[model samples]
Target: MDETKIAQLRNQSIPPARHFIDGAQVSASDGGTMPVTSPIDGAELTTLARGTHKDADRAIAAARGAFDDGRWSGLAPAARKKILLAWASLIEAHALELAVLGVRDNGTEIGMAFKAEPLSAAGTIRFYAEACDKIFGEIAPTSPGALGLVHKQPVGVVGAIVPWNFPLMIGAWKLAPALAAGCTMVMKPAETASLSLLRLAELGHEAGLPAGVFNVITGEGPVVGAALAQSHDVDALVFTGSGATGRKLMEAAARSNLKRVYLELGGKSPNIVFADAPDLNEAAKVSAAGIFRNSGQVCIAGSRLLVERSIYDSFLEKFAAQAKAMRVGDPLDPATHAGAINSESQLARNLAFVDAARAAGRRVVTGGTRILEQTGGTYMAPTIVADVTQDDPIVQNEVFGPVATVQPFDTEAEAIALANGTTLGLAAGVWTRDLSRAHRMVARLRAGVVHVNTYGGADITVPMGGMKQSGNGHDKSLHAFEKYLDLKTAWIKL
Candidate 1:
């Protein structure tokens, strides 16, 4: 049982969650604590500080002092690389521990977390670690007797706020490059998922990451997160969350130090299927996997499925059957394709969208209700809605659940038009055997990342971001390093 897994974690000597500031694990100012509950069975794993603006202040101060002292920032790239690589290695070794904690806390399926979270995080850390010593500067030939040199330096005091769905992995996405670039960071892990982050802080300390080089404070978004975003000492703020929240963060950044802000926000991405797809059965299967993956909690989920009108009925048939066959149960179950929603609030929000769509007269082909009520784990079955129009709210808005809306399109141009209809340009996917049509779709889609004949798959080597309301800048890959570093030019006259 999923509850059994929760008990297993409890039986182990799991450390208590606490604030890590200046390399010390401490409690809230008043010793106040917030219960860290497992969505797996609504069990309280441990309690962490209900971090406040004051907590944010403490972390920021430490970060600023670290950056100014240059203990981390001033180190040779190779030295920094060594510390970061060791940190990555330790994380890899503890990958399973991290994954189990994530599944227990974040409601990510244990099956997926085991493969995705800690390993990906470790990979991300190493990728950037390898790049630390390789970052180079350039010399420009100046006019007459002058020399101009351009250099890249770490932007000091980055404030990173990671999302609840993939807190540890996304934190690594921000942490790796920022640390490699010699920047100190005060990380704000999502309140729903802070245990892994706290553990990460502990692991980093064990790996000899200098005190204050990495810090963590956990609290509600309005308090600790806002304070961090509004801090004048923070040079840059990077976030992965809702577009609505991203807009507010941008404003806060402007209001504070006019610091740089990078965001990877929400999406209502589309997955289009044409009649002549390379393998229609495989296309349907993969697309179902896309939206249904992570219970559709991912920002780049193919929430809107647009099938060619000619093959609409048959494709929907295949997709609906495939989705229904997916087992929905305990996060700890390896066979469970979908797990719990992160929290009660998130579960309610997901259910509301499904209900609203059903009320709008869209056909619920399968799975529009909560399941696994016995486990007390927050869960919803894989939901597929058909006959939804582009203008419908269900089609236009991001449901953020194991839910998808289906529509039919006749032509490639129509498919592109429908896919780009949303304000988000985060991600989209197309399935087709026509090479020209595939190229056309990729070139025309407004999303920052597109998958041809596939969906929702990107590695550490590729850049991930969005356009329009999806926010600015990129995360993952070498491009992410750009946000953490500042360019400086020096001129000399001989």
Candidate 2:
């Protein structure tokens, strides 16, 4: 991570991206391509193949052929584990290169992307690799003359669509488990962030993954994503994106072969602070970091903050100070605390939320404007809007940027109501020294993951998902295996 080396990698030339289908890099069938512009400096980074339904069909056929022929699915569990471990090691070896490439592609700060993108992906692959051999079938008790057995098997070809934010990390969450469970895969990374994943699949092949066992197709979601969702050859579909897209994928599944679709969608998570919190300063720091890190592109970010009326003013001061003190600059710069927003359109969307709140007579407490326009990169100052009501659009919608809404509540009951007011519940946080209240909040908050006295930093050991409009299905744990696997029952008579 030397400053000079970082610059060198940043300036390194990245080749045009191509689809990795059937174990070989190929162009779109129609020779179509799309320009990929860097959000860091507004430079054209590279071009990606503009894949169409034909490309999707080609990849699907490859995966289907590989699975039906048992090239990957028929492998011994230990053998699959060995190859996957090799893939993880290769990923670790190129961790820095991959991290820098991802930053250049998606504008995530190197400090965060280095760990969150490549290193985290390496660990996830390693985790699932080690678990493949350990997974077991079951036996069921029956009458004396009868014997019953239960078996767990790979669900066959998997189709995954991951978003631009943290592509490598989220891609592995789907790829590793499916591959380890003996399923072949065809993945489509977001149009804006397909380079890292294309490179990742190449590494997988280099680590001895069989041809067609893992394929990646890059293109517009409407074409590639729809093709995958509706492909009857695909046994299941996994996605991590917005709620509207999730609903569309579900509908496509129903209209097709009823392919099981697993979605990890958006969130408007709440972070509540009680007067008797352990340390108000620490809570403020963590809460600010939770929402603002990665330019608040995190799906589980604590976007809505609720504080007790008694300590509301003091806590808001600390939180706003934290947001203001963060350095927003080039993602490649190690000194930067926050990076560029992913794209110009996304930055405009974030600012619109702030503008609407300002016009609605809400207090723009701190940092709610665009900055660094001279650099030609899309950047937004971390924004905090205080005195926000439950009905505020900023409070209800998922901005997916470094924007947060603050509100004060008089009692724990009111705090709970405000926290749970949104239809989306992916994650929540409670800061309090009262153990009883902590447990009660955990029980009542309708979120998949609730952080007590902490925010964010939930490792891959637990499940991460959402309830309500936030979408369904879990990611990041052994629980994730449930989606890629199928259970079968066998009855025997003596």
Candidate 3:
């Protein structure tokens, strides 16, 4: 990490961004543009083509045509694998540029953004690239000298809606596997974080992805996202965003061609700490990082802290100290532990949660106020609210900020109940050295991923999905390929 180079990149001018549709940079049909403001400071970095339903239709038509003609879909699996690997390599080659661009766009700390965005995207692409060629169709068991074949075919065209917090990373989570499986795609990057992914689309084209094989449409979610969801030509839709938007996509699918929908909606995940645990200090540190990292913009962030009553006071002390110690400032600065909030609106929302907690007489354990406003960027102190019940709105809802709520539970059953009390069950953390209790908690927790001693850092080898309102269908791992593939059975008479 060269600080000088990062600083230079941070100051460099960005080119005008446009939608990458049909292998070319294009403007919206209506010639509209949206100003892209960098949350690193209150500065307009660039302008992007403001897409609409017509633009989406054009992109989808291109994808439909490409899929139908087999320009990409007709290629051999190894050929597709080669191109995808090339794309991944291109991403790695431009990792720093993309990371800086993303941080400037979304205000994630550069230290975290480098790995979380571009490098993570590259790794994801490579993971699916390696797996695509190895999957085999099955030969079904049959009677009387008859052979039955089961084929795995690519679902035609895929539509993806990715969020702002980790645009490139989450975009690749949908893009890589679908491309690996030979599905053409049209994507709508979140309005706030479109630059990196638009650049990613260009790299994909440079790596020899055919026109319409992978397209990006940039604009507001309601117009562009809704178009992608409702397009009858789109065979499946995958999204990583809020639950409200997820429901709209589902409704659009139902009204149109009934495209398969896979959603990774945000969660209010809980992190539990017990008395007889491993190092409480380390648990407290990891738990704080789990939520506070990326400014708690992660979909599966540990926003709820459930501490055992026996060690409640002590654990709260450690946690609040950790929160207060985090340096929240310019994202480009390497010394900063946490970066700016993604936008002014999000900062306001986070503070509202804190103010409500205070109004209700909850103890503001550490931080609850906006900070570094003199710098003209959106930043907030990492907040912890103690003495709150599960019924508190701050505890129940996904604040999607650096705000965390702490509650105490006396018994193991009570801890499990409180952890599972939220409707959103995306991820959870259980810190305990007791092997039997760890196993029991893992079994009992309703989340998609449960960490026994760790809070975050689950790798791509495992599936990440949600249960209940958190939405369905897994991302990462081999299971992700299933969403892009369709199984067909062949019956023959002998």
Candidate 4:
């Protein structure tokens, strides 16, 4: 190869085999490996160890050993706090490199990845690190001579299954709290984006996390993921992915050992814009950003845009115009607003949603096509569709791409009804000047999160989760630690 070709290859390929088990880097037991591919283009990024069931067994055994051996869980709260903080600091040192790997593997815009991914990961880690010392046991009031107390203890051997999108952030969400609670864990990253998670294990070792306290095994969901879910040694499984996959994992956990299963699933969240919205232009822009920011690949993408009939036409016009102007190109470009779809399969899936919407008589206001001219990366223009009914597939299902379906409602009640019409209730957004209406909508909406005059706005300090089919448990804030710990009540008679 020419020097330019060699440089391109070098830029695309990841480093040699690195897998952390028992606080050491080792090859897979069976000498198997899987090649990591860049979602932006068809480039081989790296070869990760294709972990097997035996590896899963060994990882689980190691975690069980750590937990039972009492090296971590037995430590004082102050000591655990110190270790977690050190881990956070080490992660910060490698944040930029990890962010670059995430962008390359998942096709996220590099600039946005650099800003959001690392901050999201580090903020979550720091939040949980500080929380380590604050989690206190309560002394219950008891009759004269009797005594009662309640304490929270770490749930041992957490098996975390993270999705391809926002791999680093979600992995941190699961890891930070578990580590803070003094729980050992085995993590499984999506086959499409496992590089960053593996890299995290290396950093964790550098930060002095105990052997088997944090292990990452990379493989397909059916193999490695199922093994983790079904392993009797695993005490709990935390997952972020599609609702169907979540259900399957739950079933596996039930059949195996009845382990605790916490999930954050898919969403078809609504962004409701009323006629009384304070700033139509601003609302339209925020709405567009929420849906197009991650190429609509986010689980909480505001894919269903419900507009009040009084301003429906004008809102659609503005939203469509803004979406059409988005720049879809290389993810590394700072000016690129909408980057490549994560993979070819994702691009195909997105195009199918557009075709289905058209066939269902929905109107495509702009950008119902793919951009093959935009390098070898999979690029789809930000799409806006109107005339969609509540029963339409686009409105009901998680499109998970840069496609937003718009519908008009005649009344506040109708808007609220349409907003809560999906099986998934992860999040919802409202744009209105009326404080009373915003509060009322927030109250009535079934979603766990509601954003007023905004969409997809989130903070690390807030509890984030959903009800119904959107799955159980929260992933952020102080409340998140509850998922990794078990509470026990002690009663004594005097």
Candidate 5:
């Protein structure tokens, strides 16, 4: 960016951010704050209030009060729908600021964040808002003299914890439906990328949402997050992150209120290419997108590539060249396609996985080392590894980076076996022109979403989530509404 633009952005003096609770921004109880550093050039962006257990308690109490008081929950579905649509409009109005905030805070590519993340978040809110008044409860006749009515109602207080990669987008996946269903929520966005959501909570209030209907607490998981999970008042907990943390949250929920726990965890999804695939170059490009896009921070990234033996060597060559060509630089650069790994720890973890893969005797096809060392930013070139086996740790584990492992299979059966080798069944991609083969692969693959030609092309209308260790509960579409709602069947005897 030009110096003049940079100066203007810096002079914009965004108010010092704090926790949004009970419809207001408040300081942490202990006056504690955590330094939020920019991953772009390692600049200190700002300091955020470090919420503690007390903050969580206050937020939950506010949510509980709002729900019990029927201030938000008592509103008609049409009213909530109107309020949520206004919230979406507010997000769209502030898209540029929110996108820039995400870029500075999370180190995502500015262009991608500017158009994709914030805009998509606004669209999501709008989509779910449209569903509010359309939700239908069913009525059925009993065998004899009774009638059964299935009434769908909110799950009460929902505690949502979204990750850092696409905080605005994924946060919408949780918040929109919860709000539309008349469930008040206390959300804890990943501390690494909490700014936009805090700003979002402020927008919620601006959109005329009731006080305490939506709240945000900023801190690490152990303190504020665990407080939400362990709170007896929180009716349900929704999370999207690593499985290890998900287990802890589940245990906390089980130990306390036994609240309904919904999780969307990690994945090692497969991108299978057959010999008869139309346009090998296109397939190769999408395969690159499955991992290279967002620096492979996506949970359902197709990190494992299973190519037919006939196309194995050829596909690897094309994929490696594409991976090697990905531009890595400053996040704010519009031309830059790849940016810094979100954090130092994440960069370390990504590099460690490469080191382990090398030690395990896998041949590195392209990138395996860090780049842009002088900028003080955490940057890495897209990496591709050949000779990956079904049992390789890189294939079995979720390497949430720009790392793709290629393996060759003999037949359709072999491809299916290799793709389904891991415990994760979040997503997979099949590249073949044969209609029968596509259908066959789709049916056999144990994934929640199977892409026929494209690797990752989805919208807010389509339900997204995973099977097996990738965690349960859908995140998008009308199905996601079910997670935040409970069904009550009333039997009327005549």
Candidate 6:
């Protein structure tokens, strides 16, 4: 990366004007703003509009107006489809900028963010754009001349609260389907990383979305996020965060107007590597990637590695070696395998988890300490823990860090039992070449999504959600439309 190339990349990444409301960029009512800091080096990246309750009110009112006015809701399916496709095109045009912002704001590796986030976001937008036209009403057989039909209608104003991890992409996952259903929205981006979402709102306006159809409010969760969840004007609430926060949002929604709530919450997913795995070496590499990718901040990260007792020694040897070899450095560096933790608090929490695992008699196989000399940023070395029991605190809790605890299981039944022991049922992986074992594991697993031989592989075409405390309601594919639309049975008398 020469000076010219670096300059070109930096020029390509432009932070958007902070607040987007009613198709305009404006500051908070109180003229208050917060500095958006890059997690890479703790540098102040940009100042974003710090939304207050007044701003939240304005955004909600705008969303309500958009839904009631029917500028978007009343548009023909084809017209709406065209506009959404245009929005997707704008996302594609600024994909690199979004990815760069993601890395700068959230400390995600630029290369991974570039390849994964933008493509996923654009694919989501395109998926919903195509789905807009496909949403149809169906006629049912009726007696004589009587008419009976089922029609799916937009649910009106929607409040979308997205997490910092994969900010723009997950925001798109929430925004696209809701917009395609002709619902107006108020988006609440996470306080830590909101740059790309603000940028998305700008592109959405340029793509010809109606005023008030899309609005954004940026503030802390207790203030802005709670208001969105509890707003009477918001007909539905969609959230991605911790299970505790999701529960609070649910309560808020109930207290306000019993608004529909969809939540995608926490996970303590298990990645099982069996003795009969074809390639223990490859399994170790894939498992390392599964947990350490994104600094293991992912909600569906396979944080718990359950190995068969017969292969635990060999597996730990290879896994520890791979973990030790990961390059933790600046997210801007394309060669960097892992980046810094998102924030100081997150780093502290990860460190505490490591301590707890050690206290519980688990052996630290590899990296565990904070790399302060690496940069001023929050960086946790990739860690591997062995001899962890199923009852260990680290194994059961959602550490949300670049840490993996390897626990040996005696039999397939024990592995299944231990994997499903946690309250979360978000995602799990089974690494084995045996087709019968794969089928059996998939059938027996309690998670909503189970990976057979690999992990962390999902697409816009697939429906994603958790079975239990991880939260409900599908996120991707046509099934996600159910959360934004209501089905009505209409009967007409001849």
**TM-score per candidate, in order?**
0.97, 0.99, 0.99, 0.96, 0.97, 0.97
Better of 2 and 5 by lDDT: 2
Candidate 3, residues 1-494: lDDT per residue as tens digits? Answer: 98999989999999889899999999999999999998877899999999989999999999999999999889999999999999999999999999999999999999999999999999999999999899899988899778799999999999999999999888888999999999999999988899999999999999999999999999999999999988989999999999999999999999999999999888999999999878999988999999898888888888999999989999999998898888889999988888989999999999999999999999998889988888888999899999998899999999999999999999999999999998999999999989999999999999999988988887788898999899999999999999999999988878
- Worst ten in a row by lDDT for model 5: 1-10
Cα error, candidate 1, residue 82 (Å): 0.5
Question: Which of the two candidates, 4 or 5, achieves a greater lDDT against the reference?
Answer: 5
lDDT of 6 by residue, 231-262 (tens): 88999999999988998999999899999999
- On a 0 to 1 TM-score scale, where does candidate 1 land against the true structure? 0.97
Task: Rank the candidate models, highest lDDT first.
Answer: 2, 3, 5, 1, 6, 4
Greater-lDDT candidate between 3 and 6 = 3
Candidate 5: tens digits of C-alpha lDDT, residues 1-494: 34355335533655567999999999999999998877887877888899999999999999999999999889999899999999999999888778878878898887678766779989998998889999889988677788899999999999999999999999999999999999999999888899999999999899999999999999988998899999999999999999899999999999998999999988899999999999999998888978997888988888999889987888889898788878888877778888778988888888888889899999998888888888877888899888977777877888898899888999999889888888888999999999999999999998989999898888888899888898889999999998988999999997
| C-alpha-based local distance difference test score of model 6 | 0.87
lDDT (CA) per prediction: 0.88, 0.94, 0.92, 0.85, 0.89, 0.87
lDDT of 4: 0.85
lDDT tens digits by residue: candidate 4, 104-137: 7888886677667766787788888888988999
Instruction: Report the backbone clash tally of model 5.
Output: 0
Where does the lowest 10-residue lDDT sum fall in candidate 2? 1-10
Shift in Å, residue 226, candidate 3? 0.5
Candidate 1 lDDT over 11-86, as tens digits, reads 5655567899999997888778888888888888778798877888999999999889999998999999898889
Q: How many residue pairs clash in model 2?
A: 0
Deviation in angstroms for 385 in model 2? 0.6
**How big is the positional error of residue 428 in model 1, measured in Å on the Cα after superposition?**
0.6
